[model samples]
Target: MSTLEIRDLHVAVEDKEILRGVNLTVNSGQTHAIMGPNGSGKSTLAYAIAGHPKYTVTGGRVLLDGVDLLELSVDERARAGLFLAMQYPVEVPGVSVSNFLRSAVTAVRGEAPKLREFAKDLKNGMDALSIDPAFAQRNLNEGFSGGEKKRHEILQMELLNPKIAVLDETDSGLDVDALRVVSEGINRFRATGDTGVLLITHYTRILRYVKPDFVHVFAGGRIVEAGGPELADKLEAEGYEQYTKASA
Candidate 1:
């Protein structure tokens, strides 16, 4: 099975440290949820893994199935089977969603998908996400609502089929119905048994739907507590008060 290992990962943005010696592991077919208060470095871990230039890796190693991810560039990391669904998807006003997705697929696959097959796959993914067919012609995430952007992210995940998906607050801004739709799409992706998921969120609501195999409480830029799914239930009821207080 594919494996993503984070070893004492330390990340900083603009000379200020964010992720401080965080360590975790996710195996294919396993879903790990990271819950924490705002600015607790949950998203920082996601960006650092995706090789975001803004987040400097002060120290530590991120290995994906024995390859040192820190040695690869952002696009190279994508080709190496890493994907990140941003918390706030940016708008590309001139690039159509269809074109953008196709380009990304080509980059990751190292070959262009057959046009007919690509179209079919795109349509199927969109249909599964309940996205309108007309969205294909629209610029990527341009003029889309929060829920639509989030669904589009899942749609990309479905089509790209990365080995590891680092979803940063994907459930944010999604209404109940949208949350269900998005969660279902994630579930479908996980069913493939070849992809690992790192779900980062503040609330446990999404955990109810996605059902993480492991739950981690991120505080002070590191995991302070970890347990099974029941940990999520406890967090939902008690909140991050204890963890945050301890960190403080």
Candidate 2:
């Protein structure tokens, strides 16, 4: 089975450290949820692992199935089966959704998918996510609702089928109905048993629909608490007050 290991990861942005020696491991077929207060460095961990230029890894290593991921560029990481669903998806003015997805698949797979084959796959993914077929021709994330943008992110995950997926605050702006749809897509992805998911969120709403195999509490830039699903329930009841206090 594939594995994504984070060994004492340290990330800094603009000469200021955010993630402080964080360590976690996600195995294929497992879903690990990261919940924390704002500014606790949860997103920093995601961006660092995804190789974002803004977040610099000052020390430690990120390995994917034994390969040094911290050594790879962002696109190389994607090709190496690492996917990150950003908290804020950017708008592409001219790139159509279908074209963008096809190009992404081409990039990851190292070759273009045939028109007929790719068309069928696209249709299935969109239909499953309840997206309108006509929107495929629209510009990516341009004038789309928050829920629509998040669904598009999940759509990419479905098509790319990465070995490891890090979703950063995907449930942030979604309403109840939208939350259910996105959660279902996450469940579908988890069912594949070949992709490990590191889901980051501020609350436990999404966890109700997609149960995490493990729940981690992030505070003061590192994970201070880790446990089974019960930990989520505990966090929901008690909040991060204790952890934040302890970390401080």
Candidate 3:
């Protein structure tokens, strides 16, 4: 069975319909890229799946490994092996990165990890992201640069090791080097387990580093096209204009 499935999903924010109806399935050990122009509801899908209170599910269901995710609370969903890395991660002042990640790790594992082991793992994750070990001591995402915030998100993904992770605009503000680092971190997370990935982005830069197993084009709040890797290449060459016009 697919690790994550969105069946006829519908969502809205403040009664303004965003995701009209969407469907996608992600199996283990595969990466699926959702590409589209701005305002195509790509971010809305991610937020709705993650149970953002602002984005209400108006219809359909989201399943994780055949379990109805809609029945679970936000934290329950995370504990059930679902993770969403936001396009704009919030900054938590007064919360050290180490403390925040440790808490998350504890919550996901249902027990506190040994301090030594947790520290070691944190250091390793930071190293993988090319982040300095000192970063763990700073406030979570507070005062962090755009690239740093993205890297921090990947770090949490590595430490949590969720079954399916939805990365929203993960490469939005990254430089070449930082993009490579973030991509490597994602690859490493998948390597640890047969993690399924749903990557949402408007650009194709990160796709070059992390090859996608499937590509879905989003337009007008729905998936207009689904294909193999070549779909991404086609989008890069011809742009989303053709798809947008066709969908319109």
Candidate 1 lDDT by residue in tens digits, 160-187: 8999999999999999999999999999
Residue pair clashes in candidate 3: none
Global Cα RMSD, each model: 0.7, 0.7, 1.1
Error of 3 at 201 (Å): 0.8
Instruction: Please list the residue runs of candidate 1 whose C-alpha ends up more than 4 Å from where it truly belongs after superposition.
Output: none
For model 1, give the RMSD to the true fold.
0.7
User: After best superposition, candidate 1 residue 111: deviation in angstroms?
Assistant: 0.9
In order of appearance, the predictions have TM-scores of: 0.99, 0.99, 0.97
- How many clashing residue pairs appear in each of the predictions shown? 0, 0, 0
Candidate 3: tens digits of C-alpha lDDT, residues 110-212: 9999999998998888888888888889988988899999999999999998999999999998999999999999888777658899999999999999999
Q: Is candidate 1 or candidate 3 better by lDDT?
A: 1
Report the lDDT of model 3 for residue 82: 94
- Across 142-182, the per-residue lDDT of candidate 2 in tens digits comes to 99999999999999999999999999999999999999999
